[model samples]
Target: MSTISSASSSTTTASRPTARNLGPKPQDNRIPVTPAVLRGIFASSRTPLEERSISRVAFFRFTGFLLSCLGIAWAAARGRGIKNSAALLGVV
Candidate 1:
């Protein structure tokens, strides 16, 4: 039982890959950008036309920004109300 467990553990550890085992990473070429490249990058062929089937990341980011704006507005309103209440109590 002990030998079997040791063998299984060794096999599992050996099967796992190290960073050096993987080859070098690919480098991006962002130094020289022309007008054409900029247009291609911004308006690629894969650009979604329909609003309902847009990229998930873009959708989430937009939603997060909208929610943040709403939260800021709510906090500002609440803070103003608190200040008014405090001022009224102080006057009384």
Candidate 2:
């Protein structure tokens, strides 16, 4: 291969993903327009009661995430491994 050469084999060997090759940083996914953040986003424009109302997208997404986590936990408790639990969840 281009990366593995005969000269290198005659001297020192190279291993991939070395110390300096740590992958990209994990992304902290903060929702830009979630229901909870609405109060802060529209604090000046809207009344407190109006800002308290939740966004439909945010509500569904939060509920879905919560339910999916609960289902995975339940499946794991039943002795199903991650792969199997994920497959079972796909069917559900």
Candidate 3:
């Protein structure tokens, strides 16, 4: 039947990858480790502790700023709300 023929063609097409026709493959172990690449890797690997120290400092500063803002907003709101209530009660 036509259904069986189409299914067989679809299976054959799907099983073949298209990359095989692109080009010849390069050598796997022939990659050159140049001086710049070596230096970049060494610098990246050596800076983890320094990066952690900088990140901690930045986090501490950010948290302190957020806490200060929250504290200021809370104090302002509480003060205004209490004043309004006291004024309504004829106490201020």
Candidate 4:
């Protein structure tokens, strides 16, 4: 019983994470911008960037594509639920 407990405790301690084991904390001065967050910011009606950069323009196009996909998906799902072919094709 003692040996089993000691082994379990050692394993738990070894599995525990240290600061260096993980990436920078939220409080860190420098944090990298993720693509999802950047795209989301641009997808908003009002964007902060005045001058267009590569990332900004790319995200703009991506946002448009995503919006269109969502619209089409919504229409398709609605059509399926309501059993309306016209709505599925977005005719109405």
TM-score, per-candidate, Cα-based: 0.33, 0.32, 0.39, 0.31
Q: Tally clashing residue pairs in candidate 2.
A: 0
RMSD, model 1, all Cα superposed? 10.5
RMSD of each: 10.5, 14.5, 12.7, 10.6
Candidate 1 lDDT over 39-87, as tens digits, reads 6676665646632355676889999999999788668767767555455
Give lDDT tens digits, candidate 4, residues 1-92: 99999999999999999888899767888657999788767667554464356568889999999999988888768767856667666787
lDDT of 3: 0.79
lDDT of 1 at 92: 33
Question: In candidate 2, where is summed lDDT lowest over 10 consecutive residues?
Answer: 80-89
TM-score leader: 3
lDDT of all predictions = 0.74, 0.69, 0.79, 0.79
Q: Give candidate 3 misplaced runs (Cα > 4 Å).
A: 1-46, 82-92
Q: Over all chains combined, what TM-score does candidate 1 have? A: 0.33
How would you encode candidate 3's per-residue C-alpha lDDT over 37-77 as one tens digit per residue? 88677668767897678779999999999999978866876
Q: Model 2 misses residue 92 by how many Å?
A: 29
